[model samples]
Target chain A: SQQGEEDPQALSIQEGENATMNCSYKTSINNLQWYRQNSGRGLVHLILIRSNEREKHSGRLRVTLDTSKKSSSLLITASRAADTASYFCASGNKAAGNKLTFGGGTRVLVKP
Target chain B: GAGVSQSPSNKVTEKGKDVELRCDPISGHTALYWYRQSLGQGLEFLIYFQGNSAPDKSGLPSDRFSAERTGGSVSTLTIQRTQQEDSAVYLCASSLVASGSLNTGELFFGEGSRLTVL
Candidate 1:
């Protein structure tokens, strides 16, 4: 079964604008990781935030995790056309042997 | 291979035919995983292999789907009597660790094999 759901199933914005996608999961997670896919190709690992971590940033990407609310959010600042892709959040806990359970994903479109 | 490599970047076969997809994970990686993604849909976990043993095969959709990893290296996923619904991109990924913590929460993924069952 899928573990999480990304909100705003789809998002569209002009270049240079910011894009934010939210994800919510059910069970407690030891860590959460984000991924990006372009043109139905292989997924690229983006950033990971552990349960104890509240927020993490890599490049223009910022991920915030709130274990109390069982949710996380991905914020992309200075969106570019190249940033258009599907974003997914995967949850991994020790009980699951680090096997990830992924979410529905949020599709973002950056129009130039 | 420097990264996970999957064979037959694309495949098309008749409905009743069986298809085999191969995945060669990065050298020395202890974990390998397979996932299926329908058009515009989320990834559906198919199977996971740690070393040569699959502690979790629960994600496989049906009896038609089966996979095996040999010598802790290459893995193959076979689908028998392929159905149109089986058409999707099959992705293979690998990580350095089997369980516990990941130094870098990263999984190297192959370009994936696009399978179309006509």
Candidate 2:
């Protein structure tokens, strides 16, 4: 069964706009990581936020984790056309052999 | 000078025929993983290898799917009697370790092998 589910299956915005995507999981996790995929290719690791950390940032990406809510959100500020891709949140649980359970993902389109 | 690599980048095979996909993890990476992504969907875990420990093959969908990692470096996923449903992008990722710590969750991915079982 899939542990994580992402919201807003698709999003469209102009360049320089901000985009927000949400993910919700059913079980506890040691950490959650986000990844980006271009054109259905391999996924690239974006950022990882531990259960102890409420928020994290890298480049123009900001991620927030709320254990109590079992949800996380990824925000892309000043989005560029290059940022257009599918974003996924993968949850890592201790009982799951440290394997990542990925969400269906959110596809973002940035119009230049 | 290196990252995880997979080949062939694309493959097409007839139904009932077997196919093999290869993955080469980055040197010194202790953990390797195989995942399958169907059209417009999230990745489905297939198998995992961590060092010399027994591989975790719980994610394989059926007995038709099998994988082996030789020398703890290159791994191969073989599907016998392929079905059209098996057509998907097979992705390989490797990480430095298997612990779920904040720093260990980063996974380096390969370009993936696209399998089309017709």
TM-score of chain A of each: 0.96, 0.97
Query: Residue A65 error for model 1, in Å?
Result: 0.4
CA lDDT of each candidate?
Answer: 0.90, 0.93
Question: Which number leads on DockQ?
Answer: 2
The sequence of per-residue lDDT tens digits that candidate 2 reaches over residues B1-118 is: 2999999999999999999999999999989999999999998989999889899999999999999999999999999999999999999999996746556668899999999988
Off by over 4 Å in 2: none
lDDT tens string, model 2, A1-92?
A: 47889999999999999999999999989899999999957899999898899999999999999999999999999999999999999998
For candidate 1, list the clashing residue pairs, or say none.
none
Error of 2 at A37 (Å): 0.5
Question: What lDDT tens digits, residue by residue, belong to model 1 across residues B1-118?
Answer: 8889998999999999999999999999988999999999998988888875645898999999999998888999999999999999999999887533645547889999999999
Query: Each model's TM-score?
Result: 0.96, 0.97
Instruction: Provide the RMSD of all predictions against the true structure, rounded to 1 decimal.
Output: 1.4, 1.1
lDDT value, residue A19 of candidate 1: 99
lDDT by residue for model 1 (A1-112), tens: 4688999899999999999999998888888999999986899999988888999999999999999999999999999999999999988776877788789899999999
Report the TM-score of chain B alone for all candidates: 0.93, 0.96
Model 1 misplaced stretches (Cα beyond 4 Å): B99-103
Candidate 1 chain B worst ten-residue window by lDDT: B97-106
